[model samples]
Target: MSIRRLMPGRAALRYGLIGPGTHAQENLLPALSVLDGARLTAVAARRPDAAAEAARRWGADLWTDDWTDLVDGEGTAEIDALIVAGSPQLHADVVPRALARGISVFVEKPPAPDTATLEKLAVDERGAPEGTVAFVGFNFPYGQSYRKLRDTLRAHGTVRTVDLRMVSAKPTSPVWGCATVTDSLLQGLGTHAVDLVLRELGGPDRVTARRADIGTDRHALHVLLEYADGRLATLLLGNYSNRLEYRCELVTDQSVVGVLDDFNTLTLSRPSRTPGVGVLDGKETLRHTWPGRRGGYGRTGYSTELESFHRSVLHGEPSDSPLSACLEVYRVLDEVRRQTGDRP
Candidate 1:
């Protein structure tokens, strides 16, 4: 079916959330509340008290401790979509359940604990009725800086090499990491970096990853993704950092674009062919300060991504982050785990 035909002329789409935790508290829930044509219908948490509290805080009509009841309930009547932000271990079950009932799923990173589980989830995804879609919450891809940067790179030409770094403080809770070393850090956070690289250079032909235990079970990561088209992306992950940091540098034949962490600024520099020592800046160079697209650090980007998802699901179009993208992410993460010996 064509995506344009599924659009509902004038009605708000309802969404349900499974595992409404800190991320939900800080980002998703707040974002959903303000979006037009989208409603927060239900929320489920690990504990009933937390679920009830989130439901109340987020204005969800229903709160439950059991995810099965929420996802398996009547089809899209109470909830048009499901967001699985729970632990990776639980996603394998929750996402499949949601899809079986013909509901759209927006699952957070890692997808599952291990390759086999992720494979099972992929298999289940195939069985989902056509038009059913799933998304992994790789928020960085939808960022204003990233979107503009990616578009610029694609329009100019192929990206030959990319150097990326992602650093975050040790998670507040170890449950997020679970049994695996640095559990979801490399999978959850790394997923974002991987997705960006793939989006910029398509899928890679080979991926190699290594993990080191700095102090918090997982500390450092060195990943190399080689694309068949000769583009390469190198990822560096660090958790034992003082403050959160994200940096991406894309070097192409035309120019070099660098985006600083927190979307603070973007610098585009192209060296001149002149025989002088070097060119610091040129007339063609563009220095774009932060807040170029949206007001703050991705405040509007998240809203835009969610709104796009709502429109896509309602219109039966390709989801903002489709199931195929989710599968590729899982495939890359699985290979990373296999190389790093970080299976859960």
Candidate 2:
């Protein structure tokens, strides 16, 4: 559905934002403004200046440096949901309280600083109010190229192997190469890779990995994931790259496909079939490459994800980024850290 379809109603989804970082400023606020059915009711940030500035910019009714002013029911807006885009370490402290107050929440990935906190949250979310939904932000699965990749893999039979590669520079990399408190790359940024694998191939039976600290924070790493049926997947990540790059390749019985960059391109390869002879079937492969749309073709990943959360809160629909799913992603990251001997 288009953003216009969700406009101006008594049932509008009112929101209170808990962080005013670059992500919230550049993406979420703009996206939410377009989500006409959702109203920005309050703003809270660690800095008083940031909070007041966001409030003035959005015309929100309330602004505070303390998030409790929003979730504690002492704030001005009668919000139906809370968006927690604060530090990853604060999710454990913030999410549970939001749920307890019967307020739905949308949090960024790595839902907690560690597995122990996430485990408790998994339980808390399960018992939250009837319509309260909690979501984890892993937007790649919502991208157009990723969706096409998943569909192409389905038609080609089971995925036999996958190679996921991502590289980026320091200071600007997503999650900054690695998390300092937890699984580092395995959880902070690698959770997207893990979540993609889980959605397409179910859970892995075995996981192993190695980390390389090349000046950057464990700047490079290699990961191996083994499935119960003997399928294998590999992940490689680096933070010392001169520029940002992302590439993914999946191999199945009948075809191979690659999704590159921020999922803007798809490259497919399949065995060639000759009319008279089967000689070219295994010897040669036919390849096709096409550019995939990011935001123009329809709802972008960020828009769709926000719409998903809006629908859940307004219509009682289920969220794909539920606490359970977030926990599952964390579990894989926990395993990766354990295997690699990452410190808590």
Candidate 3:
């Protein structure tokens, strides 16, 4: 079945949300609420009370305990798009069915629990209706600071290396059906790092070296990616920090260095005319910071990602983070999982 295209000045694209958890409440729902191009038509969750509460809070037209109601039941007829903010396993299950019905989808990161399932999703996306989009929510690349860093690197010269570190004080408890804390950490946290690497440096020739400190309470993973031309990228991911943090550094062959701090600030330094001059003492340094009024959703890319997905559905534009693009990230993640023996 082909989806109905929105006529100019018609009603906003109707959206059905599945898995209205904390993440959805804090990020996706709030973002959707503010989008003029999207509407919350329905909400579904594992618990009826939660679903009802979310619908009421978010001003959705309907609520249901079974997610299938939004995908295959009466609610399906009312929705033009689906947002799956569930677990990786649930994302795997829900996305294919939604696409089969000609519904565009915006699924959260780590789209599936494993590479095999993600491959199937890629195939399903290819076979879906021509205009149907299967967008994955890897919002880090949409961050203001990171976007600036990409522009800075491109304008500077050939990129030589990229270093990214993401760490958070996430608990060891398995909240998403992952069997081990290490597995949870990799899927929950490390996928973001991997996706960032792929976006910045493309796929590496190979993962040259990897190290891990997997403990009962704290976990850390370090991966070194090497290119055929001697370029390099390093990923440092951990769940042992006192707070959530993201830091990225990029170096270009033109003696330009860019640093992004916590998705809010970007600093770029160009080589000075005089030799052996430090950036601190040089004149060619530039800094940009996200405005405080934009809020966390804008700084962290959630709002931009959600808005982009909505625009794609309304205008027949290609998804920025389509399922096909996500497969490469999963391939790299699969390799990391194998090397670290962090299978669930």
Candidate 4:
């Protein structure tokens, strides 16, 4: 009873979008042009003018200020899938409703404002119609550099340790109605870091250490994760930097080291010959860089994640970033909040 079988010979799947913000305009909307078997049929935003402008610019046939128009009103009947790129609060409100109607959803990262809301959303997702696909946008794992790193790690032996750092410029104010700058960072940016840890090494047994420097408009956090085994992972997340940077280094038991930089470059260092007693003994390096022209939408995995949602909706395939999978990551995030005394 696959969705594909149910809708025989449908040439293209229609999509409704909520939130025509900068992120959607710059990334998601542009991605629709290259997406096969799909088209943007409608768009809804908080402001009437924004919705109108987005529809005009992106070739969407319908536009409305009230998101309800897409969720349960006029636009709902026209769309097979809904893309939610608004605030986490909006996601909390819209995702469940869309699922109830059997509409597949692709929500941006930080799926909910808090872990409890995300947990509730998971319950709603489970109760959703048989073939509904609920996907969150943890796109880092889908990036080319991270994919290469995963392949390299698989070719090698067990990973002993992982070090991840994600930093970005300070925000002028709290994002998406988060209680504080620190809360916003942990929920928004830190989710990706935690998701990456879970992808590489399963859930950590405990959060060994947690520290944060909370400020009025900027924040920094350091967290250490220890597995039951000897494996370890550390995350340095912050929004007080001069620019955006993302890097991850993985060390394996087979004397292999792989580094993924900024979701575009991967560098691996391995022993070229039998290890000598010296520290810098015979070793060679291999580097792979994504083409600069491919653009961030593809290079950073926005397109890939969207396409995954498309396939899951059309073919009834399980989503790669389902809400259930996010529970563990949020468990770690909840622990971080408790340890750091961050509210909301």
lDDT of each: 0.73, 0.73, 0.85, 0.85
Q: Which residue pairs clash within candidate 3?
A: none
Model 1 over residues 274-336: C-alpha lDDT tens digits?
222233345456666665445443532666677677777878787667555666766787788
Alpha-carbon runs more than 4 Å astray in model 4: 1-11, 212-216, 272-281
C-alpha lDDT (0 to 100) for residue 334 of candidate 1: 72
Count of backbone clashes for each model?
Answer: 0, 0, 0, 0
| Cα error, candidate 2, residue 231 (Å) | 1.3
Off by over 4 Å in 1: 1-11, 74-76, 171-178, 211-218, 274-285, 291-294, 297-300
lDDT winner between 2 and 3, please give it.
3
**What lDDT tens digits, residue by residue, belong to model 4 across residues 1-344?**
65564553543799999999988988888887679888888999988999999999988889999998898897888898999999999999999999999888999988988778999999999999999999998888887668778886676777889999999885546778877677778876789999989988999987954665556666778999998888999999888788889999998887778898888788877675643223423565778888878666777887888888888888899998999899999889888888888756
Model 3 lDDT per residue over 1-344, tens place: 98899764635899999999999998888888888877888999999999999999988889999999988899999899999998888999999999999999999988998888889999999999989999999888887667778876785678899898998998577656777676787787788888888887898899843656666678888889989998899888888899988899998887688999988789888766633344523666778888767677877888889989988998999999999897888778778877888655
Which residues of candidate 2, in runs, are more than 4 Å off?
Answer: 1-11, 171-183, 216-218, 274-300
Error of 4 at 165 (Å): 0.4
- Worst ten-residue run, lDDT, model 3? 274-283
TM-score, candidate 3, is 0.91
My TM-score estimates for the predictions, one after another, are 0.84, 0.85, 0.91, 0.92
